[model samples]
Target: MSIIEARSILILILTMPTLTRQGSFGSILSSWSDSNTRGPTISLHAAAKPLMRFMYHRQVLAFIKKNRDTPLSKPIMEIYSSYLAFKHLSPSTKTTILAELDVRIASRADANAVAESLLDYAANLLDSPDANVRISTWRVLAELAHHRSTATAVLAVQPYRRLVELLNHKNVEVLETAVCALAYLTQWPDGAQAAVSPEILSCLVKLLDSPNSGIRRWTCLILGDAAQHQATEMAVSGHLCIGLISLLSESDSEVVENATYALSWITYSSHGVEATLNADILDVIPALLKSPTPQVRRWTCRIIGHIALHKSRASILRLNPCSMLVSFLSDVNVQLRESAIYALSWLTQWPEGAQAAVTAKVLQYLPALLQYRKPHVTKWLRRMLKHLAQHEAMALAAFRTQLVPLVRLGTLVVSSMQGRYSALTKFLMWQTKARLWIPWRGEMGREVNDVFTGMFGGRKRRENGALIPRTS
Candidate 1:
């Protein structure tokens, strides 16, 4: 039968009673099989093609519905095998089949075997002349890359070059899906190494300029995952750093987020840090720090922290991001707060940064962070406070602003301050001694110094017009 005849039969089957429909469908299949006993003929195969496609589609749909809540039975492999044998499934049918496979791979433990079974066939379809087939195939490959076992299986087949080549497809949908597949595939170091050729890197850099935000976003994701490996990190450093920095100004939040995330990972290498600094990333940081997206702000802080590792303190200090970073210490997101504190810890390692931290009133928020039970928060907080304490001016600022809370917690140990006493205790004793002796200065200055010197084994000095504790 032709497609029109097949459709009429399908309508008749649907209009019949359920039992009658089954019997009629079985009879049609039986008649088709009986016809096969004769010599194969063009008319017979042409008539059966659409009928066979419809039958397989119904069987796959029914199988998916029945097994929605359960593991796929072994029969699914047979159904999938027979389904793949049809070389001319419509785009819609191909999409539905691939989508079901994607869902199954994502939700079912046993689906890895199914995915592995389909890997070669799916890889072959990546080059299908039809855009829909290629797009659907890219999506299934992307989903497969999500699982470690299937991801390795996908890598074993080596589709990275084809994925990279598809990035040049004229269709934006194909380009987006191709980039997405690369994004997931590059999550593995080996996969990243395979996918990130010089040509592909150049393509991704150019894609950063794409008007489609999704293309840019997935490109950033690919670069970000590629940057995790040291080899790819260095490879991506100078070439892609500038493109990524430009994306920081993107109107789309997710594009900005992935760009920032990619930059953060890129900054892990010294070469990446150098390239980012050369690209003038500092000028964009203050704006990124104020982004409404918490992830953008968090990763921007991380970029600053990593740049600080390269001793780019002067440039960062010139930008004055310390104030903005300090503001995030009070943010409701714990992870952002942690990233801010981490950035401040690195920034405060120098006197300028310490002064900036003090000028930003970081101490005001320090005590509240102490109440957080998370180890990472406490660790970064302590390091930030320690760096702040290294400078006498910042130390005095902390002493004046947070002394009561620090003393109450009893964990505030200013390594720069002398003697066995806590900095707070020593500062308090010295303050009291000064106040008591001021009235009798002419007669008791030396004697009072000697008294406190013997008691605490240290003395106080006026440095830059600020009282600083001196070690004996």
Candidate 2:
């Protein structure tokens, strides 16, 4: 349960003989090792019981070290690494050995040493004319980093220069493994930000554009996770947001989520959100809102909120930024409706933003709430009404000269509340302060239910419940 134990397990799982076995071993390792122990030191005794117990792997490692010069040394060394992966060996042991290997590989005198010998074998395996060998070598190299930072650093020397040479290899698995290995290698301390070199970025970008959704998703995820401020800068400066936006329509959920999240994060930086606003990219929101997936809609709403919150000028220039949101107040999906309401309220809290909403005639949509059936729908509507009513002067001004459509809908506002206490509370408050804004007419009845019934028709009794007559 220590960092040493976890890293050891990571190394072991990485060296598993077969991919399927690797998965089984990884699950076991993950479950047995707590996240806090994810670094180095400590060890795992293979839980294989009396026959193949892995607890004392140090003995096996000692045997391999002492006999490393023998004819059986090569296979024994490989078996030892595989066993380490199987036992979930500590990363410290792997890193110590890998560092020694790096020094040996770098020294001509020690070029023929066990460390160098193993790496040379790995290199040869990577270059094998056989596709399986190349794929296997790539996997080993990728996993090597979990145990050895030196091996990780060694891969970045050419930073996939040699791997790139083999990219055109006829085998897709080899190509895929090479890319995966490069990504995995880049996670090492030495390879961290260095992995974002021009060549690697180009390769990843190309893969992102590949016809394969899996490749695109993985590539995007890697780039998003590894390349931080730079990627966002490039995305903004190069107008890549458009292409990134298009990826939202990807068939894969992972691709859509990562792409959407990445774009949103990118737009959060200085002048980033402003850039999108300048381009008038708000039109993208409605499509995303209509997405069949709830998560997509939630993220889209979040992105819109981020833009509105970050850009004051953009908010002012866009008088109707939230004009489209009023319709979503009655969405059948409660979560989307909640998110929409939050965005609208957040925008309205800024005085200039409220002024813009008033100027855009957003109040007109309030009259349509009477047509909705859910109490929850009316609940949020009352909240909005109360908020507007609190700003009595702004409300009256927006109501009279600013919102022609709302006025045209008539003064049935007081009657619309009928028996709804929430609506009634807001109506009373509004009338108390804005009496001059109201036009007394007989058609504008005083009873809450009567006003709404006139506009949307009366509720009818049903065996199950009270159901409103739905005109649309």
Candidate 3:
């Protein structure tokens, strides 16, 4: 036999008495009368222990592949069902045996029959006395939760309360895994409904206050997925809006990123929007825009983008993200620049925002962004600037033809441009080289000041143009 096979055989020979529950000292003394017999037995065990240990992990990996084609074979099933599987086996070994019941069994002839038994076996492990067994059990549930068919079978057992109960566990790893298991379950409709139950959502929201940033991050992610269903959103929005929005300023970039994603979906539905508006979420946006992390900034852009897409300036104007969105038109990150202007695409759709766009100098920077190659950015840039020119006479007059294609002058604004041109045009014509006139290092604050003052009555524009503080 090969070396590994010979060593495994040696281990079985030396260890079977102990494994079979008869290797005690009294038993050994009674069983062996001759010193000659015990000498070789003791020496064989001494040699076998290390070899068996070295092969332990390899055996686990090989067992997975060995059972891959027959995961529910009679002997494999017996190993799981046998009392010795749980009683005598080390927790890690029990974990490996539990892992053997993963999604691979879905295609088996008896998959449906074995699924509940496997799920029941795993569900019981959540209360296992050993922490390692509990952690591995969490992994097994998360794996099962990842597939809808097995997830459906798993959920049918009502594992939500048991899993949610672990949200308060003292172990960081357990709490994080529990959140992930719930997050995976939320991928299905029934799973989401069950997860959003009042007790579970309350525990989830309370976790936002967790001292562990990672736990808070995972909680936010679960809420994000949970927010997709309308019933869940209605149930969660009021309770979760403030907690989630507060995390926007979290010091951890990962926590901030996850919090932003959660807030986006939470504020996505009409009910969510209404609840979010009452929560004063808009008050936090200007501060979040200044967040140093790019991912936080990125998802923050998406949160505002979602609002602007659904709600008009009736509420958005109160937040006045228009000027702030315009400021990033000159940012170093191209995607940030694109998000900046794309955010404006919704804001400029309204007359008030169109006017803000004019003050924010969308006209002056229009030429700078026109140089970009990303088609989407270029499209949003043209569309937003077009919205500005349509509403504000100053914006129309500021347009310099040398900067763009005439085709961008769509019918909405172009129809009015016929037989009527504004001061922006007058100033553009006067400056003729307006494109080459503006400097790149700083902003066009002065150029916009001159344009608006000369035509619109300038009291020197508002410096802190924040939308929320101005709300009555």
Off by over 4 Å in 1: 1-69, 85-94, 108-110, 127-130, 396-472
Each candidate: RMSD to true structure? 15.1, 24.7, 17.7
Better of 1 and 3 by lDDT: 1
> In candidate 1, what are the lDDT values of residues 370-439, reduced to their tens digit?
7777767667766776666556566556755675455446444444443223344333333244443331
Clashes of each: 0, 22, 3
- What residue pairs clash in candidate 1, if any at all? none
What is the alpha-carbon lDDT of model 2 when measured against the actual structure? 0.53
Candidate 1 CA-lDDT value: 0.76
What's the TM-score of every candidate structure?
0.73, 0.42, 0.60
- Each model's lDDT comes to 0.76, 0.53, 0.66
TM-score-better candidate, 1 vs 3: 1
lDDT of 3 by residue, 61-99 (tens): 676677677647656665464521354445666666655
lDDT, candidate 2, 1-472, per-residue tens: 9999999999999998774533243465667565456586544543344334334446555764775455434555576445434324443344344443443334333333334335634554445554544555556565555345345435543436566654444456656766677666655534545556566666665666667676666555555445345543453323445556667767787778766655555555556666655554576666676677766676666566666556554553354556656566556776666656555654665566566556656565555543545765555555555446446545555444323333234333333333232233344344443342232323232333354455457552222322233443
Model 2 TM-score (2 dp): 0.42
Q: Return model 1's CA RMSD, one decimal.
A: 15.1
